[model samples]
Target chain A: MPSPALRVLTDFKRWATPLPVWSGRLHAADWPLTARHIRTQGGRLLAFWGEDRRAEESAYLVHAAFLIATGIVRTEMVVDPATAVYPSLTSIFPNALRMERALYDLLGIRATGTHDTRPWLRHAAWPADRFPLRTDFPGTDLDVAADRGYAFPPTNSPDLHEIPVGPIHAGIIEPGHFRFQVLGEEILRLEERFGYAHKGVERLFRGLDGAAGARLAGRISGDSTVAYAWSYAQAVEQVAAARVPERAQWLRALCLERERLANHLGDLGAIGNDAGLAFALTQFQALKEEFLRENQRYFGHRYLMDRILPGGVAFDLAATDIAALHGAGRALETAIGHLQEILAEHGGLRDRVVQVGVVSPERAAYLGLMGVAGRASGQAWDLRVQFPPSPYDRLQVRMAVAMDGDVAARMAVRFQEISESLRLQEEILRKLPDGHPYHPLDLREAAGEGIGWVEGWRGEVFFWLRMAQGNIRHCRPQDPSWTLWPVLEEAVLRDIVADFPLINKSFNLSYSGHDL
Target chain B: MYRILREVLRLGKVGEKPPRTQRDPASASPSCFRHSLGIRHVDAGSCNGCELELNALNGPHYNLEQAGFRFTASPRHADVLTVSGPVTRHMAAALQDCHTAMPAPRRVIAIGDCACDGGVFQGSYAVVGKVAAVLPVDLQISGCPPDPDALLRGLLRISGEQVNS
Candidate 1:
């Protein structure tokens, strides 16, 4: 007899993507049992979303994509319209708590077994019973409900008190509320309330064509625009059965690396600022600005938004562009080397970050923490390495891993990733492929679903697309921040309230991405 | 400390010279606080693209502080309020309360295309159209995200007649 992992692989038929994927429809009764079986086999739940399929069939379909040993396996099950309830996977995968809550808030589906049923993305903005993502819900109704309040569980201790931070933070940052229960300076528990940044992006993708949908995907999170656009393009290409040109693949890789370098440079500086090194902030910000300016010079957009489209990239690089890229990489490498030495020798910086905000390897694995944060805590699961597609597969990419799982570990990972990105950029420029950059896509007759998996700067970004005759039916773009945000609440425990900013910056999970 | 000082001096004065522009009387800074403007920023429901440009205003290149503009942590201490994003239903109340908290002579500057007139996110059920729909927008700087240079120029115009770097 084979293990459950192998057994499940046989159960689902293979699906095509850059990553090895197998997808199948399952009976509703087997949803929880299959989730438990995969959890027992040490598989990680990647993303979970619900779709309103009432127009075609009078049932709602819920989908779960899991990261097993081989690759990604997506499973879907149908829920009857009468009950509109499905068994919860929260007991098996604790990270599913928010996704389940959000599923309920967006669609009117109920997760029968979860304890916490309070709203995740709905903040009394609409009526209590009104579901936004349903096919029947009018997309333009502007009526709002009065505040009915959320239930943040109270601490029983007389000694501990709560500190409610803002949906409007002090700095020039996105809005999300954080509630910390503290005894003096030390934190006992932390609960987060988001949805202040939800723009109804998924609903906006309903009738948009491939080009408009790709543009909306890029804006899903501005920082990871390239990743989201590339991912969205890949999903469309898969569904349309179009093969992107060789040069287009290389250019996409180049844009992805540049995006990674820019974000990491900005984050390293912010982490230093949080550690009380103000000089580091100015220096790093200058480096990142220079990098972004170059992005505008070469790629046409600083953030590389809309550079990627359905079948391929919008443009190709000239020989002079390639030479310029090589030159920029060398200069950045030299400057970063100098900064790394200074940061290493700074004692105050080391003391502030070395052991703070620690999440043990065991804790990280159990909680399903992923991406650069996961890599820092010894979760060595980079999609670039695990399931390398195209350029990354050929680049022989190196994975950065640190076992300490502290602020220092995360900073080290960011620095290492920056160096690796520069090296990758140099290699890509040296070996530039010759071909057209784009292939125009026509998905008018395409009627199917596909998934786009890309290792975005923060972590693995998963985009699932369901379309009929070129028009999108449902699309869910999942950010790794969904799992990382809960881990942040865990990282804050037993640490002082003042250190929250430092800890949060170390992880640098996205508020807009998670809220959407 | 010596290396840090040396590196700092080596990279001396990366700030740019301010662009010359005619100032509009409608959005001009009040005479009392013209020397420096303490601005408070509210991210009503942005994609953080506008916030990125806003942060760059404080970076060494644009250096709005040297040009007599800075961000304040409190609304009460602000002379101007810069808002980004089309106002979301969840954030509308908080944004209104923030505006009400400001002292008299308070000016509102909408920072992005979305904030200006609900750019791409217009008419969504969760969105409240635009920043002007909720607050009295005194100035609107439009871009998917207005670049740092545009943001700095807009703020400097609000600061006074003389915009300097």
Candidate 2:
């Protein structure tokens, strides 16, 4: 049987012509199909992006693509580069509502049919005339941003009053403003304003060499540092058609799983604490601390930042560290078991989380939800299981899915994932492949387009890289948080104002991850 | 009831952690002894690595609250303003406003490599550089995202305590 993507491509070729390009295949584009034909096929619009192709001509167009379960991605570009306005995909996909606005904010591309376009990420950071991502545009002029203002949508009904929270929260957190129109604790509408934490990372990528670019990817979202770095490394490797040593591939998997494990532990604790269960917080927090200390003692950095490089990992595991890791994994397993018992005993905690903040299974699939959140809501999609780059294909991942789609479901998924990661960790250490984990990546002269995808703790972290003359032309690290945040607006519908914090914590989407 | 009683019995003296008993660079501050600290953290534009480390301070191990330091929700009640990130253009005004909200004798500490000197993100178009660019910094903790030990040590400095960097 042809792969799922090959089957679609075969069918598309019969009806339409195909267009292809080179220069390391930096980005994906092809002959266009009408929006009607795209919707007819059973495809979900995974991500919508833009690439500045000024060198080809002062030309650029926004890209929108759909990814299906069969390891196949189909791309269809809308407007010609010369024409700035094009039809939007939101008519077909709800997720594109945010992506199209962001595409316009950064690149000055407008979507003709998009409904909500009241500035997604712009937040008046630049002048109306200037698109910062364009080639000819100069850097930010501070005066413009200072004088700029945002017209946040408001409600006028007598009973529906407005409430504004954050950009700066009460706790140790990132910033973003959420304005809600409420009628006596019932939220009529909730609008979110971001770009408060925009660091201009995509623009900064233009100034980096390949290796330097890899370092920045790790810092994209500290929690997913390993996943982002690995994604970038895989992209560089794909562009050059380089083969990583078997040892290095296994080592990378180890780090990715460890990153996943660490995040799950931390979130499990935080989610419990937010629900007003202090005991669960203490138990899980202690477990998380133990795990982090192990990571630091072995991996050097507690968060594993800058550990994964473009070629391979920066450090190698010694026999002693391997032994230490083995022991630590066993200890964690036992501790988690005890924690699970405590969780089971606390029935009141379950009531708080059980049916609270439910996302229907059909909506999750339609919205293209990802990672832990997706799995909890019965979206059977994972990059590692679907498109295993190397080690995971052989690792035999066990998929977990829950139809409940509640805060409890998400937490349960996290728990199951932690168990699975621990099992994978032990198996990897036992079947330790011998050789050097560090490989020298020499991409200084290499140029091409390559895509790297890995199943991060949150979901899938995707990186698209284009290189020329040994310098980065474009780098896009698509954090799963970008997909999760929009779905959160849907999830919080009608929930009481007090439950918002509990619900928000359950998803625990990253502001920095989405802001970038 | 049976499990709770057994656990209480099993749990021995949860006494002082040695690190807090020492007099450091922070104990030298006269106000350190007079007032308990309430820290309000702000993330201008960090990668969230620093925020993760900061969050860990309240975890079971370090437990900053045990040492008379608690994270407060209101800047009005805060005795110190802790900020991270290389002050993004959109956040510059908010940072200034947050700093101004704190009462006088407020200490401002810049944590993480980004906050100290803008680290990897220095000279970017969007950032206004480090905390020094937006607010006066009293103590700066260094590292890409300083580990819990480094942060705890630096935090101890508010009480007039000092330790090896």
Candidate 3:
């Protein structure tokens, strides 16, 4: 059965009507024309990638963008022999700005006629001529010298004071610098300099075969380990067209929801704590601890690391474990419901979150912002509802959206998602089918590229993997944080600097995710 | 406000006394001082796995403060410099600078395998191997991310606070 996306691509010319997703390959010259048409139809660029296949002059650049309203994911391929730079889509889709920059950093495929040509992902440490993602770019044992500093946008105003924070912060959070140009307490501009946590994650993917790559995928961002791991597995399986057992599919969904629960619980509490309310912190953290302990008891690891693999999951739910999880859900529902009421009535907390860090629906869509934050900002594009996998397709997922786009909206989205996840978890346990949970991948499946997308707790976690000769050829794990981090700089604009922490917590963008 | 008071009252003090890592630290290592372990954490290039476990340990359950484990903001005030990740290039200098900021007799602890010998990220171009590659690590707590309890145990042992049976 051809995918609906593929069907839409084939039928693009036949019908005058716009589909949710319209995708197909295009000639290098026709790229701009196709992109313009998509833009006119209100499509947004989700991800742009250049695949550096060193296999005898047959390399191509791939672009995947979403037309959200119709749930369309149009995929296009480009092959160039001369100046491999394609027409700049950033002129059409603003969100493609950083992704296009990263393309050049990785594969030397510059977006010709693009607005900004600044080095992204790769900093001064890497030499100008060296592109790390090239097939010949031996990623091992690179001796990098910190040769230069980043070219941050110049602050021309003399009245504005500059304050640089992080890469190493006051709290136990991850590293990523933020440069704020301000007047008194209000801000004029905020610039975020990430890639400080860049661990050569994409480069490391080449060192492992399919199974081991799953491990690296999970490690891409630990909080979204389940999402990344599942995405990676789905990509590998899609290429192989492997038949995953019904039971395993259900179990994978179960793990995904548990991950969603754990993160939402933690973030809700953290957001409250950041707003100067300590009571919410204790209650929520305690509840999260209970959730994690149950994860450890059933799944063998608290964070569910290495639990997901190539064709299926590593573990199956035991009879007693399912019963226990069901019981835990009931307890969690009551506890969360009680905590939710307290947070709703708390006036001080409400004031801090209400109008602070507002990202308009227009800006959110322009940035291609996703996950809970996107939903909070009135973007009703949840992959589970739009383009779901096997188990999720069967389950009814209510897409939550709020127009306010403030910290309050974000918190409200999390609350609603938590309850939804709990509901899904109980339903999954009630209807789990019996079969083998793990299927070993066939070696013959190592020749083509496949894309895996999952709506992780932080939003959408996407992975594009191409395997050849029993090893990964090119792997690019796109974290939703890359899109949302830029919005944080936008979100914190004009707000007093002190409220940065609260705003930051509401979005809770991942440095590792973007840096990777 | 009343809810806050009642919650705090119910969740009183942490139950256990600080586990004595050792009967005495002065005898084992004359150069070291052990009492309150002020830890300064530097995330060189981790997946945020170790940090989460650390957060969990500090929260109501493990109660890191009860065990005399505290996370300090400055290396100057810290006795142990706890570092995680593969020591990414951008962070290499910062890690060295943080180690430099600590006065003499300061302990360096590498948390997670990524910090130990680079773990899964050892050969990657962006990193400079491990924590020991850039700093003089006294103890290495191993695991993709070592369990928070294991990390606490490593600290007590390295700080000469672990009571050897």
Q: What CA root-mean-square deviation does each model show from the true structure?
A: 2.0, 3.8, 3.4
Q: In candidate 1 chain A, what residue range of length 10 has the lowest lDDT sum? A: A139-148
Model 1: lDDT of residue A38: 79
Residue A481 in model 2: lDDT: 79
lDDT of each: 0.86, 0.76, 0.79
Q: Give the clashing residue pairs of candidate 1, or none.
A: none
lDDT by residue (A1-516, candidate 1, tens digit) is 224554563477787656678887887777888888878778899999999988888899999998888887798889998999999999999889999999999999999987899989988687668888998886554544423388899789999999998888888989889999999999989999888888887888888888888888988888888899998988888899789888889889999999999989988899999889998989988988888899889899878888999888987788898888788899899888888888989999999898899999999999888899999999998888878888888998999999999999999999999999999999888886888889888888877888999999999899999888788878999988999999989898999998999999998877777777
- Candidate 3 on A381-494: residue-level lDDT in tens? 888888777798888888878889999999999999999999999999999988899878884547766677788999888787777776887778888887788888889998
Off by over 4 Å in 2: A1-40, A74-82, A143-148, B1-35
Task: Return the lDDT, model 3, position B143.
Answer: 89
What is candidate 1's lDDT per residue for B45-83, written digit by digit as tens?
Answer: 888888887887778898677767889999999999999
Candidate 2 lDDT tens digits, A1-516: 223433444343211111111111112222223333444565556566787776675667565445643433534343556677766667677777887888888888887765677777766567766777777778756431432356776577787889888789877788888887888987767777787888878888985887788888888888999999998988787776677788888888998999998888888878788878876676676667778878888888788888888777888889898998999899888777767666657777887788888899988977778788999999887776766767887889898788899998998888888889999999888887898887787776778667777888888887877787778887777888777887777787788787788888889888887888
Candidate number of the best lDDT = 1
lDDT of 3 by residue, B32-143 (tens): 4455688889999899998887777677766777666788888888888989999898788777877888876688889998999888787888888898988888888998
